[model samples]
Target chain A: MKSLDIWNRTYSRAFLDDLPHRWQRRAFLRATVKTATVIALAPLVSSLPGCSDQRSTSPPLSQAPWPTLAAVQEILLPHDAFGPGAADIRATPYLHALLQTSDFDPEERQFILDGAHRLDDICQEQHQRAFLMLDPALRDPLLRDLAESRVGDRWLGALLTYILEAMLGDPVYGGNPNGIGWRWLEHTPGFPRPSKGLFHA
Target chain B: MTDHYDVCIIGSGAGGGPVALTLAQAGYRVLVLEKGPWLKTSDYFKDEIACCRRSTYTPNLRDERHVIEEREGKNWKAQSTYDSGWDFWNGNVVGGSTNFMSGFFFRLKPQDFQLRSEFGPIKNANVADWPISYSQLEPYYTQVETEVGISGRVVAHPFAEPRSTAEFPYPPTAEHLLSRVFDHACEQLKLHAIPTPRAVLSRPVDERRACEYAGYCGSYGCATGAKGSARVALLDRAIKTGQCEIRPHAQVQRLISDDSGRVTAAEYVDTVNNIQRVRAKIFVVACQAVETARLLLLSTGPKHPQGLGNRYQQVGKNLIFSAGGSGRGEFEYADFSTDQAQALKQIGPFVNRSLQEWYFINEKQLGGKRKGGTIDFLLRHPNPISRAVGLRRDDNDELIWGQALKQRLKNEFTRAQYLDYEVFCDWLPTDDCFVSLDSAVKDKWGKPVAKIRLNSHPQDVIIGTYLSNQAKTVLTAMGAKNISGSASTSPPQNLMAGGCRFGTDPKSSVLDSDCRMHNATNLFVTDGSFMPTGGSVPFTWTIYANAFRVAEIIKHQL
Candidate 1:
């Protein structure tokens, strides 16, 4: 999975257009398609990458290869004077967990995995190190190149979706701790906000 | 229990729900075959990923997809559903799309009933008059407003159609602070900024609770069962009567007809993949517009070759999808006075407002007299994940990431509040837009899926563009900064109607004035399929009203 070859063709722009335009299709998809996936993604941050206790019995992320994806997401949407960033909300691990779930399409999972590898390959060639090891100063060039390419746009769009989940999605799903994202933006969530629990998949 | 029923209805949304509730209450054994499972109140929650990002409530495009055909110059190129861009909207759950609808209810004016008579032939457009008048359906419309639980204050507006009832059953709830801003702006423009009528409930009725204002309206199902969805308002009541049985996960394959040309049975694949058959005295086909036509075309028997009621070749012709454009305007809270700023910060899920000033077509829009559309003013969806994803810019042509992209997103989220605008214009059916069985593509069930060919008439775009400009003007009057949005050529695939058009003539239409098939005496179509012309607004209310009207006729005949 070096490139987009493994990404499911069903999610392609051509396929999305087979219905209507992208933004509109996505608007309706909220109620029609993603309900179960929303509950499935919900869980406490699962004891970040390495620091875990004996009581922690969640899946291990030792070989998950999430750092490059994390670095890219952080570089793409870092926290500044504008509210919280990917680092504060744990966007990378939230996305990693989402990709591992049954709710995500198998092909979409392959696409994300392949995109991370390709991004790392480009980072290594430019900065003389793997993507995660690259200096914060040098990460922009790789993102610039990826953003400029057609293949990289899908990856960017998908990453942005998860980043949004981290910022605005229900906190039970391992992001937006303590309603910080909602308070930052002042978005009045509809009543009956969920408690911490996963809906049956 | 008898395997036979008094009525066998396929699909269970606005089209079938009302009729099922009415007939079952009237002591008729009604069997409703829904393609999806029966979701409970506990089943629905604020799960954005499951309800929006994945195919949990709709047909899995990977297994079943519609083939869309695009016409360029001289060729019609086909695109398979296998692609991600393929429009895969439309609910497969028991309540159908109504379970997730925004519930913006607007009645079709009297002029909409006679499009062909009002506006003479306009080149290639296939606009026509509805077989029934708005007056005929007005009483049923009132019934839905009360029984189905519509909540809004009816005001006297120039662009509004005539009302049969004196007032709505319930007063509007969830009126946001932004609605007053729109009222002020519209007062400046002298446009009728009517309180947009929503099908969602404002107060508790019987066992259901009032809207919780969860901000999760639209895409997610109502946990409180206050949205007036079929499952909440109609099916639940019908179940208590014990006469209505909803057979979930039963996909009706075809309508089995008798030698006399009337549909006698519904053949379907049950949940366990067994081919189950149900006999009925009367059959109603309300599987939505596209699937309704597809099912009829797929039922090729010895007596009906082209398909059921396709002998006149009018079964799948003249399909119309509503065309429209959308625009969003942003306003900063810092610019407003302290009182206004406080109100702006507290905006909630509801901001029901729309201008019907252009509901009737005028000459200024088309350079000549013609039919026009409506403009709906709304608040941006509360789903923050979609809002952030919406701000991401990586369409390949331009790329912004890292700090620059992050800053842009933050500004969009926190800087200023946004208002959404949508123009709903009529899609005049032409020879270009219709549904047929695809030869090459097949669904997971091994059946030929619908092959849709869509191309909107040029006037549809012109009227929608004029209405969109009017929407921008409202934003400008309301002191919105960077206000922009225009009409597009894209048709809203979900708001589909026509195909199995109803008319008095057997040669020109598929159904009679009562929505009964012209050829089959006992078969009826109660969905949007019988609509010859979908008016300037959404068709759900009209579909529900018409279904209620048809239910009366069915009862009379029985």
Candidate 2:
């Protein structure tokens, strides 16, 4: 239960500086995969460490570590004023687990994992560090290139698009942690709570 | 008497929630009795195993499943009755079914209100004209939409009933992952893929806000209160006013009768701790269709030995279950991707109704394997569960199954959208497909459970087949591959109708046009049980409308 603001300050661009372009993309994909995997495996790995009610557990990051993967997720769905980022809500591991389970099909698993591999290869050939380690300048360009590519295989752009969507999507699927998504949308989290003026204590 | 009120309403779901609020607002002392507990949105979770398998959010049905037997073939057939499909099917909470509904709202067509005259009398069907016309109920329908804060567009359809200009209180919710595909496919097919009208608020209305893109809106309860359940809309206001008193855990067993054959009060064993009686000058039975009919039958006295409203034996007669069907398709296009499609704002509602083309589909034949029926309303944006189970691919190249299936399903698992169009033909009431009391068995409270002996006639089968084929054709036009359809073996008794049907003829029907029970001078029935003929649309909106209408009638009387 780290303060969300503390987590945010820890994730500034300075932490991502000096890493090469290709490596940064690879790292991002890795984090996305890890997140899905953790979500899928949350039920089985309940006793890993932190268990805040079965349904409310953020993904287990320690026992099942996806270093490159976790960092990349931070970059994409960062915990900011925008909403709950995947990693901020600690959803990366849950997502990683989700990928392996029946929740997702084999093609989706392959797309996520294979797409990460392809991204990493490109980053390695160009810049030096994995995607998350790269400077924001280098990392941003790589993401743009992937998104704009219509070449031998359009894996980078497509995977980035999918991951970003999931990150910004619903809290019902491990994203938008807490009422964070609602706050970002300028709406209240739904249910049982009374309106701002009516019936609120 | 433990407590007394000017008007006492039973069951706090669709009918009771609205009526209680309206009457209380109008300054009448109203008391509402609810059998289920009141739950908030936070109580719900997003686990299919718990919600679907464990039956976490539905009525406990262990006894009824064993006791109620249909005379199947020669021997009595016992259907394994469980909760329909989590909270989405049947919720036993204080908000009633609204707590777990997709919120589709369609008005009963003009013809639906007068089926006996328009369609002529079909053999064996208890077809009759409604005491009131659709035009008479239009104002109340408008009031319901406004109060519930519906988000819809009044699309133009030739056969659609006319009404004053109205716009949905909020905009339609954004299509879900699967809905995007269905939208694109519908655009390609040139057929109307209307936004299913939902009771949910699209923008903040009153105290609630728009949808949060939570994929669990359909079956599982919405903790956000964005969906227009009674807890969110009516019950809260009614309770806050303090003019209405809600007595939870009061499961009414029988309607007490005076010496004059009028319902004097209701008897019940207090589900909480104490068994007590509460008398009211007026009584409204807002219990759902099955329970309403069963209560009427259980309270048999000398004046009405058959039941409360069974002078003509029509109390539990003409049971109409929703005639339901669906179609699924797989498409190849990146544009249909969930990410890109969210930008294309505005999904249309099945708001426009055409009697010529979009009329209820019927399967004329019965007693065997036949295609299902159709009502209008294409439901897009189904969450994961519906896509996994209901929208599976078939054995065709375009359909795409097996190993490639694994890849495609995986890729689109979160992105692929399943477009669904459900047709609900208002089942014409038949004397045979009705609810009765199981004399041999009882429930947890030792009251007779609702014994449903239902078998749809050949006409119902005709309606089913017609609707199912029409659904297939609509999907075919949309390039839907691996199209399939099947009718349920059980009769349309599932949709529910008539324990207290409304008509002018006291000898034939139970209640009057205002929903007042014929025999009981002060007792009124306001649920789906009072429906003369089931409308060819989802019944919730109409049910709310009728409740409002009756509330107005009660208001005038008060």
Candidate 3:
């Protein structure tokens, strides 16, 4: 199936299912999700080649963005000779948790999801595969090319911002587990850290 | 209707704390209406995410925002704080911005009270002598040292204001090893390195504990109630008397007044969005400078049509912020021995040193007899997230990811300690910089929000640059590498005052010397709003002292 068709069908069903019963009754909210999805994906859909007849094996809309984002984060702060990278610091999970928050800006959440889709499209255009299917060496060059564009640069910067948060933020926020990032950097955290109850309270 | 209060104070920061405490102690029922939540010391911690990244202690910009108008070339551009992400809201908790202050306290020198007399006026600056002299507020400053808990060892410097007390109520908080180096550098340069006084407690004072030296003083609420915020030092004590009621999340909409031009009641929106009214013999507005002026302008009464105390259009005419720049120098570990490097890396303790050598610039090179400023030296804050975020871009402003970024982070983390200097100077009051209500933009309550026009006086930069250059010399003397500093036109949002300035002439000023509204006799503005000319230092100490001074005046009136 085409990317837009898959996104429309998968996202609408998945998002509606996630909403509370009270929220489900709000027609404007459902309309907003559908409208947002179409607006966010229109450019990517137009850029992609015809692949509607291809077997649709993409993950559900909710889970589709994470693997690409995680791949991008690993390339951004790869686990090479350096001590701890994005994966080691649990950046992707932290980002996922942040996006799930009620207080998190919805526009920013959509931007992150849209940016992931855009990255996949670029990967397919440059090399005939999804971002997750790319060779490890090819990922960095693709991200560098993405960084050349204004939106891509901002998206990467946003991801880096979250990665830094994961690396340095309190472990209670789900990143820097066991203070591994802190220990590596020789940073001494102040006392009286927030309890789990006060995580963004 | 609620029980009648002798006084209704509409803020709980440094401005309102003393009035509430003093009135309640004198057997009067005082009600304090604070716009934000009442977060105790137990609710505070040193979480970087909460303190720096999120608007935990302040209002969300989307709900309550300001319209900041800045000059872009010859034209002015207005942008909402929500769009710019430039947070104008300081600490909105019960204690206000004082909760997050670094507690670097300084008293206004005697000359500051007579700025117009001492230093002749600059071209476009509205320099005016204070209506009240320093002598009138001296005793109160001394009182704040004991009651509000200032900690420092007094040393005679050329520019040290005459203190009523020989020494601070509490001895200075523990100092870092860098202080010694700073002192030595100052000695070599023939400069008087005064031990910077802090509002933080050095030892246990009643229920409050001493400083924990958490290296996260600025921008973070005090976890130990040692920073001497208004809530901990004053309001908490007032509650013990059973005469003071602190109603948090009670955002006052306006002061309701009678035709006789006396404030009869304060109308506020409660936490549940219910409109509540309470009668009081006297009403005090101490909501800092910008919001204080906004409150008065919003309160339109029959007797005072334009707004209470705004008959002459002087309610928000002279908004001032501290105009200065900050610089940092790195102390590399490789340059020092292991012991020295270890001492350099030591955290928590403060670099309690300041230089007021240029407080009065008599140099002929710049200009003869110009007012200068204060230079405070300290350690760079240890917020690792902020530090890491700053390093995301390379010298060319390109994203540096993967191995390059990781190595950069590692090097920055382990390499050297950074010492910083902050230059605080007068943001000269002018016709251009003032607070007014935005015509279109409304707050979450559907009331017009504060619109601030920021235009700094050119001479402020000249003085700030002079002071910053002097600071760089001391840093160079301390053997710091890559020393760079400059003066900026950007205003420090935290150190603000002088919207509703007090003066003798009713036509030119909002309040009289007693801080009571000139036309509306029963209404008083006890915050930094009463400052006609804010001195070249932090305003908290002055605000605390003046509030204590005003409280005594209110006591006699009652």
Candidate 4:
């Protein structure tokens, strides 16, 4: 059931966009399931943090196969007053390293790579500009559409997973720089911290 | 050590480790064939995703595949372990899955030993009495504790089986701040919350180090040799004796026996995929229940066509897995008026609290008191990355991306500390739940893979629901604001047992009381495979203890 829940919310959620009627049904179902589980708990998060607190910004990724992804990373988890977002943490490097070194599926890697290229085309056709050059209000809705559309769902879904890894994984990797992510979350990491001694070595 | 051994052990976890140690001490040369790699202590790390995601200590399923078929009606449908569901969690490394276990040890009560006699029979379930009693195994449990090392206080538990020893070898590790809250909650509810005895060393024992309270302890291997993993606790010591040889990467495919039906040699594909046969005077099959049964079902020969000990066709019958249901209760700092909320530090690893009062419940709603199970309350694993995945959905039920996703992550991580509770109930062995060789699927070696058929008995769902409800009550008492739990129809894959059951009746059971095959004389199965009915508890301690007892019996034969 954990697997089904994860599959539905994680993978299937990306494809629900094309069918707005079916999407509403799924969203209602998701809400009903969640409400049943958390009814006794505190109400859902009231409002998100303010979206503009950019203390540190990574240089635009030049070497990347899809350079506009640097901007997409910001769009996905942009700088908020609470703390650093994906770009500030340089999530792309960590995600790239993870995809390269870890036991990543080749198919997933290809999907993400293809998705990056496809997303640019989608944005250009829809908004008459590349994803990176689009305005923030215009930029956000297009990305949300990509998440819903089947064309970019799997790729965007996987991208979100890797981005989360960057934000919360050990700072030893390039992401979560200076323990910024941990500090933001106020998460006290478990002891006997993992070292490079056994990891990639 | 000679090329050939007095005994060849097929696994390296709780079952095979003790036998290797004891037989080596008795001056017999022993060979241990572990299919997985020898991940040395130097390989131990606290990287959760690397260890979990990389299949670091488990089977890389693309090559080592299993066609897990769930019951869909009259016919069975093979579920995708990759895209859809789970594969059977076989700890594929040298120490086996024991290295990754949470180490919650609870002795099986006497009633568990004689479940058929005690509780009678349930409809369609294969509950049976064990050939050996708890008294027969008590001395060895003490031996296992003293030798292997265990920590935690043993207060009077209403459901705790009688013990010969006064207390555990080591006192409980320093309590987490949540311990006090849990205890207080249980006190108000009038449920017994005793210390959860663990197979972890609280203090330094012999050559092994003590618990460093490494918060990354549960799923990850111990960087410090505090948790009593088979490698550090047994095989490491067995290697020192110079009589035991651990041959990693030797995948045993077939067990060859003579016309008289006694085992002769084991043919295995070595690291470079060479068919290497090693002869031993005796052989012990302890590669867990599923694989042990798989090995037996795979080794088909002229003498025993149904596979090694399947003359009675009971090689893989009455499979049991622990029925599991869990709930997480989130406690934000502001939820409590008491200073206990502020003091709830997230450092110490073990919640170390369990309520066994419901282990054998007699509620009238069930018509009578039925055999229930154990519940362990735990602090959620401290890793932040996996927790971040919890933010995928928003209250509106729409997928959260962009700024909304960012803020949801912030709210979850900074705002709350959670107590996770898991209830382990009896997975009543019904004929529907068993293992067979998958005709369609094959592994990397082109051998037919094990086909696991799982349709859990309705009783499991009933017992799981009851325990989960009880867990909610305890959480409610603890002042948790958001608490939600649901009973699971699925079984905990890791806690599998009873595929190769032991009994006097040749018609119904696979192995005999001593875990020896009824048809094959020289073969012995010392894993959880020998269990007729796994009690409502973690099977590791019992598997270890029973293996120790069986080792002594095998000792007399040698």
Candidate 5:
């Protein structure tokens, strides 16, 4: 069973907005977004040469629902002017690696993969096309509508949770490469970071 | 072959550390049976996934789980921790939860020993006076400061307990710029803001290093051996004495007692799942509060049919957790100058401010004179994933994606510095809240697990709310925005105490004044379980002090 109690507590207190702020200087926001995107995506471009070896060891990205899952992730965190998008952070690959791990919860992994297939089915029913075939403009509205449902909401929440992990987790976990996420947010991680081991030794 | 020792300590946390150290140093053979792994300082890191997301420091719920009985309307419903994911096990490693604690150390006041006498008992609360007084534990508290490495600047506050020493052994840690703002606000509000004491080292003490000012102090293990965890401070020194033997991954099953009710040996399952027995002159049970009670309840002998110390059915009664809530206030960088903004964004320095102004409430609303609580102010933890996860939902509780989500993340992360406060009040012991063995559920070892019934006294919430509001007033004075906090009945799993209270009367309490089991002369419980009334503070400092005091008594007996 899903831990509804833990989820509820986390969600309810998420947006306490304990310190309200006025959003002034849209130009400053645009400049920071452009700078962050460049700095965050630099490592991905540099690491492109090593992609073939990683792809040979791992499952191919062309796996049926993986393409659909990637599409959903892109919509959730699109390549906007604000910062590096889901694709820039390699969120799909990080998630794929996480699900493939032995320690990862099998039930949760199944839930995520099943949700991607369900999203495609919903798209086919509503728009007479698979989720990937749907127009880019039409995708956000459908996702918003899907958020209103129980299963859809949890599915989206799960995806968003993994997305955050990919964005902010340590670089050793196959995400946040070159400390891109940390650089973007000016986050200073604690010292003696996990380097030798995959998780705890 | 069974190994014999002068003293055998079960569990190697705060309660067991001092006993092992003191006994071993005094030329006695001390054996510490720890259920967890012996993780060294080099093994610790600040990985958020390993420390927080995964059960790296604790056992998986699938193997060992708890059954929590929470109130539902008039009836109570019990749920396994495996299903709820509400892990009851703190740190299952060598040092126990002390390895993960933020190290906020506070001493109990003199009145806390005699809560019933200081203020008349509340209705339905099992309030009682302690057999020992603050004066008795004062020197040991000082001992913990010197021995366990406490660092703070002591100032005269409204509720400052009588101390044997004028100052802490070590100087206060490096402070954040926000502490100045907190002090100024307290000065303006006519409130005394004391420097919060920490068990972390401010300077290098022998082999142990000083605090590196790592932002991940709580939840994450100390990589530098700066935090005064049981392993780093006490157990390590005990090992150096060559008289202490710490056997990790030795899960104690039960204590074998003779017909005379004296514990002869401890039967335990080793790492290889082989049952091993260790005979000792005296046995000390310090498996935390819940497990201590569960161990006692499971060990039913010929003389003790009910349990070891459950003759009067007081072994697993009157469990307590620290009652309080946490709140945060944000300081926007836009409202400050460039230098001020830069200072606000600086990480790593500690925010060591706390308020005890309302430690004693004197108002008509709370019946004129009553107990209040402590408000500790700190910087919001710098865990990026936790912060990003919190920003996933919008104001309407709907999932926000795309640009909206990105904007929210940026604003929440880089735009402001958040100052948070945690309130600590007494979780008044009640008859409803206690620990028992669950018959239906069992651990991986097939032993019955602890079933805890959680029920807080109504006055606890009242006092908590009063303290929370007072904390918000401080935040407001500090020019903070959108300050919010509330007290709830849900217990903080880490700060647990009681269940095997120590007192003068054997019929009413499990342990005697010296913390020795009244019925079983050779058995003693040294954890927070001996606390009859947990003060309005974290129990680590008091537990360490009392254990040191108990160690002296055990030395005499040996």
Candidate 6:
């Protein structure tokens, strides 16, 4: 039941106020049972911090030629059966913004952008198709070749790892919106307070 | 723009706040200048984005973002060291690091002071004997303990220093579900699992309230004033005394010294819109490690061109950082999140009597053999996003498709345990990993920014490796699988110690055993920078103890 429905049923402040002095004891017992039940489900409810504030969808990804980057993201983390596609989910846009920001290392940013371009070139040469346009079988092999097979670019592997991590980071960073990846794996996104460090094991 | 005072204390956190309070209480005209703005407790939030991601604690990003660089002659040094760890979450506001600290407080063991006398000096380490012993500082520790209202159980560990104390103000933090498992595991291995000493009040004591166990103790300021921070505990007392004045956002640029080399006044730029000058009879640099070193290095005069206390080229040497690692366990009957309230449990600076050989001492070798750094195991509080990101197990684990894979993970998570380790050891004092001015790098105030040059010793690496391996052994015995993590040996040194290290000799050390700088007869440093050797115990308690001791010294000497 929704919280409002449950609250309306057993926790009407009016009902308690109207109870006779003798019956007040029984009413308190009834309230205790209801409060305990509400508390037992509190973890699922209270773990969410600022989750209600993240109600809006991401901004549109309509500028520039990000097709190759979008294709790679989809191939690595395909639109799941339950969630939005990789490009449509704002992973690339978020990655673009983080890389462009002053917070990230300049070298790290250049490596990521350059690696994506290099990866798309290899895909086009091998299969005459953009990386996203290729079948999973062909795209997977091509990505592996670029990521590991002594591709002249030493930072290729690192770039791939960075992209993957960015895609998987907390949605508050603009990736993994609405816990799409979490929902796909049946995980509940618990709002953790950082100052508190990690919660108890 | 500002008036003068008898004593001027730079930095308003742990070291600065107390001295300000004590001196003001004793009727000294004092001025406490904090570089950062004052943040109200309510303004502090639990958002990782605004705080952790943006580096809000030490923000002014143009100067704080550090990158690892390989200098041609020196190996990789912290290219911009002042703010490398600032990203992890430290308070830059009036409270200093204490605003974001977990409030874990522990006294140094008696052996920690006489490392040279207890443990033989290892090659490539500058482990020196502390001027004062635990006994001398014991009374002051209790005074701080009462003032701070620490909650802990004082169980005598064989490797611990003997204490002439009673029990803590409150019992240990209740063993949440996680600590019970950790305690059970350690009991089987005979490793003593002592109560973790915390500055968070377990029961309401003094004006401070009891901890709500809200699980927001590390990075954010406690809203309820439960955590014993300088802002909540003592800063108010200092201001109320009317003898002390705290000028927030007053960034001290340089110590204005006369031709005689005595610091007569300090020139500062008030963040609020004015140039300021404050003269004082004495100055105390309690602004924490990096900034404290930076301030001293920036203060140059005709008599001391190399900076006020850099005559020996030892101003910013001996930097140490408390090191950390993590381990995980998988149990058949564990539901990691079942008991939600117990998620804040922590293990302790337990004893390791046989590990004395792993340490280093600068003076005579220690004859009585026993040493151990603090080991902490905080339960891995994986929110759903963090869980999905790192939730993995290796067993040639059959790839169960879609829904089944989800179910498998949920099941495994319900039955898993994790342990994180914290090791505080002495880092060798190196002249190279010191601070100097980077003329090119300027802060918001146009003052020359500090270039932090820091690197770890090979012995620290060895100790880190040893601790990592030992953590796995304890976890393996508890039937946990896939335990891995290293104490990082990269750009950021996690355990930074020894800049302006304390010693008996004035020529070699910045401060006397009493934390008073020798050449500058009226200055003293009581923060982590004065530590001769980093003990396994956390630095806050020691810093507090020394601050009290130094305050007494100043009271009597003056």
Instruction: State what share of the real interface contacts each candidate retains.
Output: 0.44, 0.01, 0.49, 0.38, 0.48, 0.06
For residues B315-361, what per-residue lDDT tens digits would candidate 1 score against the true structure? 88899877889998987978988887776766544788988887775
True contacts kept of 1: 0.44
DockQ by candidate, in order? 0.36, 0.02, 0.24, 0.20, 0.24, 0.05
Reference-based lDDT, residue B233, model 1 = 87
Return the TM-score for chain B, candidate 5: 0.99
Which candidate, 2 or 3, would have the higher TM-score against the true structure? Answer: 3
Off by over 4 Å in 3: A1-62, A199-201
**Candidate 1: stretches off by over 4 Å:** A1-59, A79-83, A123-128, A194-198, B394-397
Locate the minimum summed-lDDT window of 10 residues in model 5 chain B: B53-62
Tens digit per residue, CA lDDT, model 2, B290-407: 8888888888876778888788877877767775454454433354545544432223222222122446323344434322223443434433332332222344212222233333
Question: Native contact fraction of candidate 2?
Answer: 0.01
Q: Using Cα atoms with residue i matched to residue i, what is each candidate's TM-score against the true structure?
A: 0.91, 0.67, 0.92, 0.90, 0.92, 0.74
- Native-referenced TM-scores of chain A, all candidate models: 0.71, 0.52, 0.68, 0.65, 0.70, 0.51
Which regions of candidate 4 are displaced past 4 Å?
A1-64, A199-201, B336-342, B395-397
- Predict model 2's lDDT versus the native: 0.58
Candidate 6 chain A: worst-modelled 10 consecutive residues by lDDT: A22-31
B1-558: candidate 6 lDDT, tens digit per residue: 357688898888888877888899999998888877676555454543344333455643444433323345645534443323233225567777787776767777788888878876756667788888889989888888777768787775556556667787667665555455556777787777666778877777655667665544565567667678888777866778889888877778888677777778888877555878888888888877767778888888776688877788777777666643434544433433444423422222221112222333222233343344555555454333334323322254211222333444455444444444454544555444665566676776676766666556665555555666666676676556667666645423323456888887866788888787767777788777888777865688888878988988877766
lDDT of 5 by residue, A152-185 (tens): 6777887888788888887766677677778877
The sequence of per-residue lDDT tens digits that candidate 3 reaches over residues B190-210 is 999999999999999889999
Q: Which portions of model 2 show Cα errors greater than 4 Å?
A: A1-201, B45-47, B63-68, B74-76, B79-89, B175-195, B332-356, B360-415, B487-494
| Each model's Cα RMSD | 3.9, 14.8, 8.1, 8.6, 7.6, 14.2
Q: Write the per-residue lDDT of candidate 5 for residues B145-263, one digit (tens) a residue.
A: 99999999999977899887789999999999999999999999999989999999999988899999878899988988999999999999999999999998899999888899999
TM-score of 6: 0.74
List the lowest-lDDT window of 10 residues for candidate 4 chain A: A23-32
